[model samples]
Target: MADVHKVVFYPVGNGDTTQIVLSGGRRVLFDFCHRERAEDTDTPEIDLKSRFKDELKAVDRDYFDVVAFTHADLDHIQGSTDFFELQHAKKYQGEGRIKIRELWVPAAMLLEEADKDHQQEEFVLLRQEARHRLLEGKDILVFSKPKALADWLEPRLNERGEAASARDHLFIDAGTIVPGFSLASDGVEFFCHSPFIKHCDEGDIIRNRASLVFNVRFLADGAYYDYLEVGDATWEEMEDIVRTTRYHKNDDRLAWDLYNIPHHCSYLVLNEEGQKGDKETEPKPLVKELLLQGKRDAYIVSCSKPIPDIKESYEQVQPPHIQARNTYERYLKEVGGRKFLVTMEEPNANKPEPIVFEIASGGVTWKRSASIGAPAIITSTPPRAG
Candidate 1:
């Protein structure tokens, strides 16, 4: 058995972000979310300045190895802006801020073709800083289409400013692997999976399909540990990856120890169903198939509210954004293997703090810093919620 590795999934705003601490003691951040919610309700407040400083303090000196932005959604990219500001203002009351060793983003994210307004300016700044660091000979790995997309997006940004090509961003194809840490060194490796070449159409939906999905793997205790974070990608995107990669059904290569369910376990990402209603009569077979294939040890959904009911009015649904909760509960039971973790179940006044899992010779064990009281099920439909 090898030493242990720790992964922390932080409960940020209404989204998902996790921190990966390797056995070698290197720290990596998967995604960072917005500081506030849309309705301006009181959730746990994330003090960016203090939190950033605290994150550095928690780890060893200047030891944050990598910061990965899964995609360009506001919730994910907003923190980078705050991070850049904090990093730039080196002197914090005469102390030094943590030095970022490297920044890894998808190649498509750095594209010049995107309309400036469509993409956040902070992302542009972060990309620029990374480029500057690279010019100074710092290691920057642009996984999946870094070269090709950088070639396309950089010039466009330079010519039109960040907002000009906001909507015209570059997209990376699925199944591209970005080589990084090896299990031998207790490092992390990403197996790229989605957003094959950008343009996917499902009507009025945000370009979440453009998200770069990846399976992060590392070895611990002589056993392989796999964590799959498939950003808010939809059914179309998932199908695309499976088909394009020729990912064999039930292949162990696709198996995972943990999975962050796409779009917070919304049925839209699993079935043809959208906000209109669930089209699935029985469980979506693919949902079960993926679970079986992945051999998921656990599932995590980062959502603000319970899954919306298909029968209710769009307004009545807590989030009204995605489909009913019953769909997931039903599907989970059918798939049956791992435990399910949802952020909304936390009892804390603030959003539940991150959930940390340690992987060691004995297997994985998790603990929570925040007081998430108990798990409760709030269905989207009336009969279930009450």
Candidate 2:
């Protein structure tokens, strides 16, 4: 029998929220978007209150060992304050508290050095807690900062003698691996794959470029487990990692069993000419090449809405807007073996409830289990050995 590793991708609509349960039972959660605030009704499936509350109850809030926030984007961090406060409040209210063993976040997201908005009160409070209170004894791992890039840019600024901007603090240094827990061992072997020192620029570009990309690898029972999670990162960020770093040189770093499509499968990451409108073009050959190189078996897209159809109007008429649906369809066709899983097809469909992936007995299987229905199981066939 194969040992088991379990992952639950909670429905968060257009934002990323996934829970990884290791073989040894340790649980790690990545990113959280508030499901309660879906009233604007931009997408059809948003039941903010139900989804958010149900997710918390489904996990019993007791399963989280590590909670990670990819960046400071509201969609990513909306639940942090709430989660923390809820746990604390529950403790005070005589309800059992969810114990978060540790908190992992990008240093740029938590530290003063990375703050571009001087007036952000939440940022200030988080920094204060992280630096003074949390660092005192609590477990907090800050991903690497871009010291080399910062140093490189520092000299240019001095030479110009213009006011040094707060943007300099946003650079993420390369090679810093966030601490991770595993089911098979004491912890999972994980490493950052992007936002290397060379990629850090300024502003949103820096945020998107400096986004932390990492891979988790472990052995559960006799089966090998591997997955990649790249937070809302773009192609420019990816190209830099491939060209400037040692990432591609190491097979372990680039390979994956499952991959989270970056930027929700948006084509903005692939071309300088942003999202192409609703028209479908042949898939970008470069994207195909990258996917082929990784040889992933499962590709997950965590988007809130149905990816815009190739024939639909472009979501954004602005320059640089790439049609997400066209990109997704083309990529799926190019990567023939891998199954593409999207979370937004049925906001209220019962056939596929919370998407569940499990590794057990030397293999993995996907199942859909909803609160109101029976579980639909799909056993995964291992990829043919090369």
The most accurate candidate by lDDT is 1
What's the CA error at residue 225 for candidate 1, in Å?
2.7
Q: Tens-digit lDDT track for model 1 on 87-160?
A: 32343212454445666665545553347674447656665655554333345655444345545545656665
Worst 10 residues of 2 by lDDT: 85-94
Candidate 2 residue-wise lDDT, 4-75, digit = tens? 666666555557777776666566777766655454555344453455445556755543677776766666
Give the TM-scores of the predictions, in the order they appear.
Answer: 0.72, 0.73
Off by over 4 Å in 1: 36-42, 45-49, 85-98, 112-120, 130-138, 146-177, 198-207, 247-250, 273-288, 294-297, 303-324, 347-351, 370-386
Stretches of model 2 off by over 4 angstroms after superposition: 38-63, 85-97, 112-124, 147-173, 176-187, 198-205, 244-248, 275-288, 294-296, 308-310, 313-322, 346-352, 371-376, 379-386
Q: How far off is residue 342 in model 1, in Å?
A: 1.7
lDDT of 2: 0.54
How high a TM-score does candidate 1 get? 0.72
